[model samples]
Target chain A: MEFEVDEELLDIFVTEASDSLEQWEAISLNLKKNYSADDLNKLFKIAHSLKGTSKSMGFTQLGDFIHKVEDLIAWVIRQDREITASESQFLLTTHGIMKKWLTGLQLNGNTPDVSEVLWTIGEYLKGEIENLDQLNTSNNMQASEAHAATETSQRTGIEFLKVRSDRLDSLIQIIGELSIHQSIITHSLNNNDVQSNNFKLAVHQAAKMTKEIQNESLALRMTEVRGLFQRLERTANDVAESLQKFIEVTITGADQELDRSVVEAIQDPLVHIVRNLVDHGIENEEIRVAEGKSARGQIQFVAIADAGGILLKLCDDGKGLDSEKILEKARQKGLIKDGTELSENEIHKLIFLPEFSTSEQVTEISGRGIGMQVVKDTIAQIGGTINIVSKKGEGSEFHINLPASLNMIDAVVMELQGNKYSIPLQELVEIVDLNNSKLEDTEESHPLLNWRGSLVPLHYLSNELILNQDYAVQREEGSLPQAAMIIKSNDNLLGFGVDRIVGHQRIIVKSINGEHENNDTLKGATILGDGKPSLILSLSDLSDRLKSNHRMEAV
Target chain B: MSEAILQTSEQLENDKYLVFRVGTSYYGISLSEIVEVTEKLDTVPTPNTPDHVIGVVNLRGEVITVVDTRHLLGQEKSESHLNFVIVVNTDKGKVAALVDQMIDVRQINKEIIEESTSSIQSEANSHLLGIAKAEDRLIYILRFKDFIQEALSRLNGER
Candidate 1:
């Protein structure tokens, strides 16, 4: 009888198999250092489930292959053996082959040839491959080749994410409704002129609960960074092995929680950074010894929740980023003019520029001239910033700050001609009271305000925003703006004048659909505490607009 | 019997349109395109948007852009308050249109609807699918997808 594979069932099996394989790989990597019975049982369970599911889904070859792996794991568990380095390496190689087969299955419902892997496992089961040295000589070359193929194919396939439960989604929805209802209650109370202290206290307490629920619901989307750090550790090890270098990698804050989407988006850039550290950033043994440093290079990855975002610091104790070499490269590439004096920090930043590579010879690892620029762009795409700090002959540290959640941000609510608008608090350097500052009207169309002994261009919020005629008329008759929000845009200070600073609050940002999406002045829209929709201002875009307007005026 | 069956199948294809007034003109959008008809919600004016987009409004928890139908149809901006917002599902998302009044939904026959002629085809009226003759009034059936795409293109042009 010919067997027919159910596409839907096969897809489920594939997703389940991929997840199990990831768990197996992570556990095997961990078992290299610390071997525990519980972890071994987890491997066994994962392998058994994968085997059963693959068989049921008509992937018998894959099932039989995993069955052999399961037996190998069972043997280790039965012997109560401490996983030596060689055994752990063997498990990891098995994982690599399984992952490649899974990717092939996902791309096109076919698994690859697994006879070689099965033969190696057969030898191990038959006691021919007993020790570390023999397994290494037999499998290392094939394993590295398989790893390369898996990496490329995995990049081309669709990434499967862990499915979130419907209950979490409903909870978030209910929290949204609760917040809206709370605002309605507040609005009604204010409108009815209820001045009773007890009633006010009750409403205030309800509001507080609503805010807490909103925060907790948002937290449901967060996941720990441990998985991401493990992948990075794997990448570091692989790069170090390929380079034939000895390195020590230290990681902290593995339990730091970030939005799942943020974690997924950051994985590639972090991996690239890790590879660069292992490849170009760290020096080899001879150079390190000659520099009076330890022979083994050290790389540290630290993550901490700072302010309202995650701060990731990747530091490498190696021949630090040589600004002179970077400057020379920048000059050779005509990226900078001759005799242009740049500070050491500025010179180090030149590496992030596109097509900037200081490597004398291009290696397979990094110097094809596309790594750092893409890293910077990816980080910036996720509302994050990356900065480099290096001291000559000391080390280089990359500081990346990313928002805790993409949709929620702390914004300072302000009024422009009775219409409420919000500016992300992170963008504002300081809020200056225009009433206290001196305004100078120059030949320029916009006014300049004196801020901290320097003249900063001041833009009236009403004039800059595309307001209706009524607001424009009101602005013409109203008094001068009372506040100026000083923002640093492109390293220059610009002040935006508004009617008044209402207050600061955490707001859930919702994208404005249709025509307004393309409006650069508005980042997005958010519902305020009063259940009113307010526009969130994009300060950087606004600055760029103002700058262009000035240029046009000059023309 | 065959003629009767043919008539019934054609009638099945006929759709009910929700008619609304902008200035003196009445426009009909198929019911499938509409999400809800709501009372005019408060809109916060967005800067740098096209003139037809009055602003965005908070509908339930979602913020939807509100387009002024009068301006979109090349009529003078409404002086009085728009009493109704017809929220429609567009390719972009849910967008609400400000109208002077909400007329009754009517099931218009496909046979009586006249395809828009090239003589009436201008940039403003390009989104009109056809004109339906119902009782004593002519309702311009709006191709909502095209209407939204045109509005978005106009916004892009302004930018």
Candidate 2:
């Protein structure tokens, strides 16, 4: 027997299988909460399509496995009975195993052994194994092994967004036409000595059209956060089940949209937050009830589109953060000096410090070394901020504010050492005129600026970035900076001195690729209105470098 | 007879190269690797880049990193002069290389290329595929992909 596999067909099958399994998992989770016939029919159709594709692709073993699952679904549909909790669990577990097999097929060009899963499904079909408990007890080890395999193979898959062909075609066509139009405008403006009012008006209209097209193109990458919320729901369910807790996960504004890249980047931090909430924030049933709260803890995910950004609130109706305990822990860990005065909010923020875990005993759920610091860092990497608000017993709320798009940002351009650089407006506290402001220069340390009564360390941007040799020479000769931009990093205010302040404008950032590793000074490059590339300064990174240097000097 | 014809056709398909001048030397890159050539545009200086990299330029709406051919090939930097940017397609993306002048697109057969020897090998010349003698000049046929790979590896190594 000879078999020839069509590589393209296999790729299509893998993509389809991956997508179908994702839908199956989501729908099955939904069905578990409330059984709906329409949802069940959707599952059946997915299974049927998968079976047909697998069989046609000559994956008989996979086809057989799906066939048996299809038969069980058909039987359930025929009986017209609402599935039990254990039945839904079995289906979810089956979904997990099939997904594992799909990953194996994608990676190794053939499906892995699924005899245990097949036999379990057979028993379910024959009414021998009636519940998930029996299935778990019988094949717990095998199930775990399958899960491990799935986790190992997870890195092989690539993320893809599915856009309609016509939409893409139109986008391409518009872009082509837009470039042609731009060249035409430039040609006339460059060649013609005099510009008429009509020509100027036409150019204005073209610019407006270009802006609209840009917005339209950017909107194409905007996806609803529903998918991310659904994944979080699944995580919450799994974590709650493992910890023997009851939690009702409610989501508001799941339809709110974010950039696809931002959504993907935020998934891990969101999942970690959910797990931490379930494991530590939410109390157990007995404790919750004794504390005059509902037995089923409430975890709510609310996303709202605010001005130029999205605000996500993850609220848990559990035992709130104990500021006293957090402060005590911080002191014990030597994170803060003894008798350090702090507000309640500052104490609550201590949990986000590295190696700050309030868990007395390490658990498999949340406290396995990865702490809230990682969550904060991940959020910060995407130009977002996470803050916490809590009361002693009224539960805690984590507010995450993220920009609508990752690439476009409003920035204040500054001239430094004859070169232009921009800083994200969100990072700027205020711009101060050096000539008008009170500045203190001493031989002992870096110059400090008395900004609103508090002394802030002032660093010359040109001197720090070494933009050119002349700046260093000028600094040696004691030349004063023209202006200073105030930046807040790590709860400390720092002043960055620059040559002059340019006006603020929205710029699209483009990553500077190849060989430039010193990202602490430069975030990326952006093309200015005059068709020149300008660097975007990373204020946080600069502040971090300054803080580390300050610490080193103190030592 | 048919096999000979097929072989000749394959040779014809692979023999074309775009030759250009950097300093006093000539270099050839495979025609397939080149996306386009245009008059050099003003480049804004980037911080923390290698000396060979002449910062980035705005090409249409996209920002592209431009590499200086003189510094890359270890030749003395040229003063004020007109140049051309030959945009080459690599595995990563399109990168534009600045050259002193565009010579001509010449077809040199694979059989005429002499394999590079150790005598002329240097850090930069290591990226050369072979040397081809045509008319009165020797064109150093560059393995452009390898050059890109080396540049990326050097960047990573710096990190």
Candidate 3:
């Protein structure tokens, strides 16, 4: 038969193969307990399907291996042979091999060699049953005819369609443009005196329809966080095995709903945190026994929906961080004072500082001072905050708070140098209006505004101007002239001075691409409902400006 | 001595390098690898991105990061009036390096190229693939991808 390379075949092959592999993994896990005739039949049918799919896809070697696996499973079933430890291992290994080949097929349009793979599996199968008499002897006294009673269950589910990301993004962009067009039509009808009621009614319907279309298209890109959370369980298994520590990773709130973008952005940081738990948090079995604790460690991920956001917590029940060692390292690196008085959380937060390390030895995985900063930056970029909490002996917990979606963002709009900008509301502790205050540029060079009790570092938006023009004063005098936006992130509270306050509006963010003369300081541009382009201010860049000013003053 | 042709050897003539100026410095890129030079590129400004990356631009539809050659060549700034973005394909990936202006294509003898040797020299020297001397003027052949890496390292080193 001629092989067809179409989307439907690809989808069916991958889905069926993945399902079979997952079933095989689950069955292998139960090999030591018992093996039912039903399980054997299921395994045989999976192998049969794999053989058919692989042959049709022109993966001859893979097809041959599946055929061998089918025969082996059938032989075990008919002979009433009990599964040996080695036989279970062989089954699991075959499942892993199939997954690897599937991934290869996904990347390149063909499967690689599997001749040696089948030989290895065949050898492993032989170790379990040296002869046909050995297999029949281990049977649970059930007659050979009993195997004929069991049959394979049929598979049924809502299928998944893999759409390329660009196609989805393009569909979203067109929907965005459609919304803009609807807005333009509404404004034209309201302004121009075309007394035709039909025009007004038509524009109103267009506005409603466009809004629904935009929302639906955006929703199509979203996926549940449970799938990602489930994968983390497998990652924990691998990490614990490699570290030679018995760590059980349990996930709570896997069913919590989150946007696909939020999940994608959080994946790396979550992986890094889990790796840290396995590498550093969990003590060795010997150490655990000495500490009078259970030899097996426990790592848990708890996710819940907070007000307007999701709160994710990763916790480990093992040796907590050494605050004293962290402080010593911080002092040695000159990141903190020698005798700095800090809270337990503050001391733990010090670990996230750049170049801060308590580990004396470097490993291939982490502790190179790269992961934490990346984690912090990634969280900040996604309008999220990660708070660390720990006790000396008790394990650490990282609380990651993130917004629901980047596309649908809630921001506090403020004006700087007569230009309007929006800061994500997640970063704002509270908006404090500073009027007739003691905000001054200090002789020490860094501007500071004494707010209530604390000395809040002040950054003026006008100071960022290259030409140093006072657009704030140049604008008409009747409008609100100056204000400071109090924002908090990474435990640092600061105030940004601006000219006016524009009420928050839901904006569709359109990334400005190519090259820009002043792109460094600007984060991204948002297309307001009215079609005006507003530049988003980079808070980190603003902090850098403050740092540079401080350095200039010192010199 | 015979008058040497400005073009390189018979094997190298077809391999044209499109030369451009970022401020006062001149740099060349292979013509065959050039994607496209676009204007008013709506680049997503990345915060804390190295000085070389002016921003990321959308070419046709792909979001390609654009680097500033003025910053790559160790210059402070360039005229925003003549913002010319030149997209080049490097071994690492496709990067759109923004320049101030486009200069004419110049051929050089590939055999006469000298590899840069200075370590304690200007920051730009580290990114320069080699220097091609043509008559009175010299052109710095920069591996733009390597230029990005070297520039990022210098930025990190300064920090």
Best by DockQ: 1
Q: Give a tens-digit lDDT track for model 1, residues A1-555.
A: 025666566556666776777788788877865788888899889889889887877778988889998998898888987867667766776777677676666556556677766787788788887654454445544554554565555566554555347647667676676666566667768778467664576577667767677776777778778777877777676667667777777889988878987887787788778778888888889999999988888988889999989999888887778888888888888999998999887888898888777677877666544578899978876678899998877878999999989889999999887778999998999999887779999887689998889999888877777765532336557588889999998679998899989999888889887766456667788998788899998787788888898799879
| Segments of candidate 1 deviating more than 4 angstroms | A1-19, A33-42, A56-58, A71-87, A96-113, A119-205, A289-292, A360-364, A367-371, A467-473, A515-521, A548-555, B1-14, B79-83, B124-127, B153-158
lDDT of 2 at A458: 92
Looking at model 2 chain A, which ten-residue stretch has the lowest summed lDDT? A467-476
Worst 10 residues of 1 chain A by lDDT: A467-476
Error in Å for residue B105 of model 3? 21
lDDT tens digits by residue: candidate 2, A205-312: 678778867777877888888888877777787677667788888899998989988987788788888888888889989988999998999999999998789999
DockQ of 2: 0.27
**Candidate numbers sorted by TM-score from highest down:** 1, 2, 3
Candidate 3 retains true contacts at a fraction of: 0.08
Give one digit per residue, the lDDT tens place, for model 3 in B89-149: 5544566777877777766556666887766227666566687776666667766656654
Q: lDDT order of candidates, best first?
A: 1, 2, 3
What would the per-residue lDDT of candidate 2 be over residues B2-114, giving only the tens digit for each residue? 99999987777678899988888889988877778999886766555456666667777667777777767778876344389888766556677788999998889888999
Please write out the lDDT profile of model 3 over residues A1-555, one tens digit for every residue. 225567567656766777677666556544523666777677888789879878877767778888987877776787787865445445655665666666555445544455655565476456643533322222211211111111001112235544447657766776766666566666766788446565666566667767766666666666656656654554454456445568666778877767777877777677778778777888888888898878789888898999787898989877788988988888877898766699877888888787665667766445644568789878877668888887766788889998776676666676654445666665566666667667667775347888888888776655554421311225454553367777764457877777777877665555554333243455565655433345566665576666687789879
* Each model's DockQ score: 0.54, 0.27, 0.09
List A-chain TM-scores for all predictions: 0.81, 0.88, 0.74
